[model samples]
Target chain A: MKSLFFPVLLAALLAGCSGTPSKVASIEDRSVTATETKFVADKPLVETMGKPPDATSTSSSLPLPAAGRSGVAVETRGLVAPSTDVMGLAEAKAAEAAAKAADTGATAKSGGVQDAAILPYSGGMNQADMKDPASLLSKRRVQFDYDSAAIRDEFHAMLEAHAKYMKTNSSARAILQGNTDERGSREYNLALGQRRAESVFKALNLLGVPEGQMEAVSMGEEKPLSEGHDEAAWQQNRRTEILYQGE
Target chain B: MTIEIVGGATNRIPIAILPFLVAPELASGTSDPALVVAGDLGRSGYFKLLDTSTVSGLPADPESLPLAPWKALGADAVVVGQIKPQGSERVEVRFWLFDPVRQTRLSALSYTTTRAGLRGVAHRISDAVHQALLGEPGAYGGRIAYIVKHHGHYELQVADADSQNAVTVTSSPEPLISPAWSPDGRRLAYVSFEDKKPVVYVQNLADGYRRAVAKFRGSNSAPAWSPDGRRLAVALSKDETSQIYSLDLLTGDATRLTQGGALDTEPEFSPDGLWLYFTSDRGGSPQIYRESLSTGKVNRVTFEGNYNVSPALSPDGRTLAFIHRRDSQFHVAVMDLNNHQLQVLTDSTQDESPSFAGNGRVLLYATMVQGRGVLATVSIDGKIRQRLSQGGDLREPAWGR
Candidate 1:
């Protein structure tokens, strides 16, 4: 009985030890997986996290069970490993510990420990959140209608999340690339694309993002996301993509 | 490049271009001058080429030629030429034009040039023939600059007026568009996206030295050279939504030429530098508008259509060409600047970038045919048209001398 108990405890400790890195690794892999799953299986996740994840959001306080912690390890296998695979894994474990502490209602202890772990990462949590599947930053593109630069209603929440991130992190810079469908004059389309990107730039500025941290430019109708000449393809081509500096 | 002539003039001149006699040694080094001249006149839509292949022998000169047979063959004018080696590197080409109906010598000329310049010499001869017959300058001696997209790479190409002898001026993975030639024809101002943003660049065609002229805070594009070539009018969004600004090339200072909240772009200068015509949506929809440089007076140019953009003025400043949309189809249309009479010049559904030839008798533009971009030219009168296509997608054609 002593031998079996020792092995079980060691296994539990080992699972706990390995679980942290796996979670970090999963967060690093989220950028690719999230984008791939976005078109199909991630609609529900988007709907659930449609609003910015606030301090009172329960999704941030949910504790991962032992089985779910181990399941993260299995999910990391098929992903394209990033350069900071080990560090990401370690940071993820810290995040998981903080989440567990919060679940136990130890807010003060969890806050201190989370800050301490995140200080060594230097905006690592923020970057991970950007790549998080449930984060609004993951949805980078804002679609536009034909010959219109008005931002759609569905993207306000996502834009707000990005605006909040930029406001909080002053060093973060973004380039707003605007595009247009292959219609009308190319020079005119270029102006139209610039208008689209400026619309987003103005929206972010109004939401408290500094103008110096953002740039607006036009790609014109030269770079089309879809090659078709029909309306459906044109719809996809008209958009603005928000890109951050240094990943 | 492939050429397709569409439509013809009502009264075409009947001309015969006979094969040129070549010396034994010069035969291998020279291109057939008669063939080049025949092509120029044939595609001009003003002349109808009569067959001269069945003729007996090449004429030595006007003294030895017989106009009786050409007259009997129903040829109104006859052209005969010969090529002979002049020096180690140069060749002498001589040609004579005879009036078959009048049974008299109309004109004669001789040119000495390198073997490589033989095509240019032939084009000049065609120009001479055209001027002697129609009393107007020919557009064959001009060059054209356009953009070509192949295998996801964009290239700026400079070619002859006939779309031959194309030389790639610049190639980049990023896009390059809106090529505008300077008044001197030695430099080209265009928009390039190599730095991940649209920046206007002016490049010298001779040495290929380029510089970013309008690299402002936001997008800088739609560069139009002033009549004096001292400045460029560009559209920038640094201050507000895309507005027109005049940028001085020497000092790099930009003066806001246009104001207000509407989007204004595609700025073009009139030949006299008196007015600046551009596309603006301040009137609710996109339309062509002109602003006086001396006075800030503004006038809407296109009133019949809600969508009219990309305004290009003729060299004489009497005609304004633009892209007009009708029933969801875009076509190249021209308006008499004086009379305000508008006429659509093309049948293609997707046409853009209409530029006038040096003579102002033809307009060079880009249109989509079967989902592929091709360069096309239509006469000012809308009686003649030609399509030029190649392996890659061609667009943004600017004709210059």
Candidate 2:
């Protein structure tokens, strides 16, 4: 009876010891396990926080010069492991982060001041291309309602694209020629045409295009695209044409 | 082409104009003076010019006037003239007006002029005949300043009121508009677009010497001479929007006369030199308005239409002529200042730049004919209408007082 009682007591003690880490384990194993466990627990916390635990921590302390030079900052907080595979995992993580950073970075860099650096033709574009009907730059004419200079919503995107192109090419210059239908007095039509040109000019200005790069002029009713005395012709006549320099 | 009367011939006074005789030596080379006289009288719409073909041989001397033939042709009055060559470059004209019914010699006048002045001489005779019969002054001898556009070339032309002897004052490849005559009719102030922008110039009619009177940064147009000819009422856009400004023709000083956002232009001074009549859109749409020169007080003069522009007060200050827009058509209208009754004198659409003749009986303006502009005139009473188109574009006609 004494021998059976001692074996049961030993089995109960071993089960209890295995259920929790023992304080008598080696420091390395304990520390690594503690850290690994913390990581598992903190991952959901980091995700819920929607932020890296330490934005500048992991990459800054690494001995990898290749990582620093890459400029591909990893937004996710990487887990630190006291194992031989950490270097390879960190590099691989960094590369993955870089790819993501590049994808997002591409979106923001477009139309940005930094974009001026990589534009075609020495940060400028061939002016002749602006006149090509198939080119996006050729879609510069902005139409308006009768006696109105207000820009329509449909033209917003086209103007934005133009604004972006103009922003990227600082050396380019453009002329906005405003026209009108043959209905009002010649002098009044001239003033109205000017208002239309100026309206486009102001929109471009708001989109980051410089004022010096563009000039507004009114051709009045003198130059009509269609001579028919009808609404359809008038609509076609009342438009502002964008012309680039030396094109 | 002959002058075809458009309207206004009922109850017209009867007058007979005989064929003017030239010296036998120069008859074949000289232009007939009777044609001009007949045209001038017929255009008035107040005279019934008799057919001279029905009459027998005309008398050369006023003493031997053939009253029986003229009276037999239902003539109330008769005009006979003789043209004699004064020299190689000049001619002497002797004209006589007769009252055939009363059988009396009314007046006789003689003028010595160059061959080119034959038209002027005929017009002067026509004026005399008009005054004698109608007991009122006539603008037959006066000059009309206008712009003629041919193949993209603009010519500032001056012609006899009867549309004869048209002389190009200055020809430009650019547009020239709004010709205003000096009080003396010796110079013309006009807007020229030589520099790709509107600029006002005053040119001497005799020598064609021109000087830019207003060349401000933006636009300088609608130049009107004051009564005294010392100042010009100009519409300038140097201060953002168009505004009326009195520019001293001698001192180069411009005084702002209006302060608003609406366009103020086409300034014309009242004949009395008291008010500056102009067109302003301050009342929401363009209307005729007058500003007192002394008090600087502004008053609205036109309330009949939403669009009235190009105001020109008659020499007597009794009538106001302007372009009135009605039902999308612009017509020349005249308002009697005393009765406040407005009468549209033109029946054509797109009539603009109405100007009054010195007699205030005829109003000359520009009208469109199948996309081309032509000069047209109407009697203030809307009785007589005539279009003077020589197959060329014409615009902005101003008759000298």
Candidate 3:
């Protein structure tokens, strides 16, 4: 566990040095910057750092506002465990000092390492959480089967995360842009894509996202994620993307 | 553009079109009208162009030409024309069609137009010859609207029937698809994704003035004009998942035409304005269905395959063309409204967006040729076929009057 924890600590230190907000100041900014650099280079830096596993559990354990919130949070934890690993802090004290030093040298920072230590129990999201790889809000794409608008079971956790974020952030707005593979008529596919987007919209609404905060739209088969004319490409093309406004 | 004639009628009329004598002053500005006429006729698959290479001199007029030589060359009909400068910027084009065997003139016509209008004049002559011989109006003098994708941009282009004199109506970094022409051929309605969502826009062809006719909350697409040109039937998803709605052009009021949980789109109006046919998946699969404008009654039209969509009705409202999928390969098919008999018109695997020509004798559609999109036309009887290919990927062809 110590062997695995060092890289994540080093990554957080490097990410803090790169002028990202201190992890103590914002857990959201540190994780987002770490993943953004991971896509460019430094692949091994945060490979073992999974999502914050206890976030959903702690949110569910709180005083429940809605009847469906607890059930959804539990299901989300189940679906999010296997595919994504939670960031484990084996050496929390040593890593926190290093992150503070890097953050101070990089920029004027506030909310020292003590704030980062308690973020896992907060289950709160700001604008930076949308880009954080550890946040369920970062999983924006929801895929569907061919000729289907039914949301798959695997995306339940991601949807719940977004729903919680929307409920917490009242001023936020989202646009659901749906897409499809190039198999059928262009107009028909447009309708199909609309159906998929509406399905996502309805799901979010049922989870308490307001109607005024969301809009559903279709890209049809015109905008394809894969250009190949095969099933593998088709699977990737049939998806709905959750886009936040002013982000 | 390159044209390939796949199959043709066996008893094609053997006709020879002699080189038209052009005035020296007008020669530099205009193309050879005879070549244009020959190209229009030959690609149509109804007439066989006889060789005119060995002919000695260009005929000044049909009266000065000898029919004996053309008859000996196995030509059944002969065409002769002459272009003369009528004024400073105008030229007079005259053509005479004669039957070599009967030794009599079939028809003669003259048109005086500006030098820039010579191509239109050539197409009109082809139409006149086609009418004189086949007793039906030719579609060569019409325009075709389609989408071309090249250099990472999409352009909506309107061109002549022979794919010449093309003008881009709109170009964008995003996609533009499903171009539908109005009944009067004065405007075009198509779907554009410039705003990160599909919205229907109608643009005037002459002045390029465009308006977003269906910029609703959700996806707005599949714009089909009514025969009277007063309204457009579009598929919108503002209230539900893609239901048909009629938008009044004058008042911008949209009335819902279809209702259900299932998806319904690709609205097309009948020529008589009595029915609105669209694609619906209410029966568990995509199929063509029509709703009565007066009664609002719905009935299924196609029951053949699991997928039949993008219905394009003929001018006479007697035939319906759509994309039908079989064994995972999409093909264009036509259905007779009276008998409900279906006939698949194409053999290509990836055919789509079938639009009938102005004459209703041929259907133009887009298909994949070795992973590239190209436009193709086939006769109503599934006999003759012609492929029209250009440099970029072309699709969504709508032939206008």
What TM-score goes with each of the models?
A: 0.79, 0.73, 0.80
Residue A177 lDDT in candidate 1: 88
lDDT (tens digit, per residue) of candidate 2 on A45-158: 222211212333342221221222222211111212111111222353454455422111101000000000100212345666566787667797899997688999998888
Stretches off by above 4 angstroms in model 1 are A1-126, B62-64
DockQ for each of the predicted structures, in order? Answer: 0.09, 0.00, 0.09
- Top-TM-score candidate index: 3
Q: How is the predicted docking of candidate 2 categorized under the CAPRI scheme?
A: incorrect
- Residue pairs clashing in model 2 are none
- Residues B309-328, model 3: lDDT tens digits: 99999999999999999999
How closely does chain A match the true chain A in each prediction, as TM-score?
Answer: 0.49, 0.48, 0.49
lDDT of 3 by residue, A35-99 (tens): 12221111211211221333333322212123322211100000000011111123323433454
- Quote the true-contact fraction of every model: 0.22, 0.00, 0.23
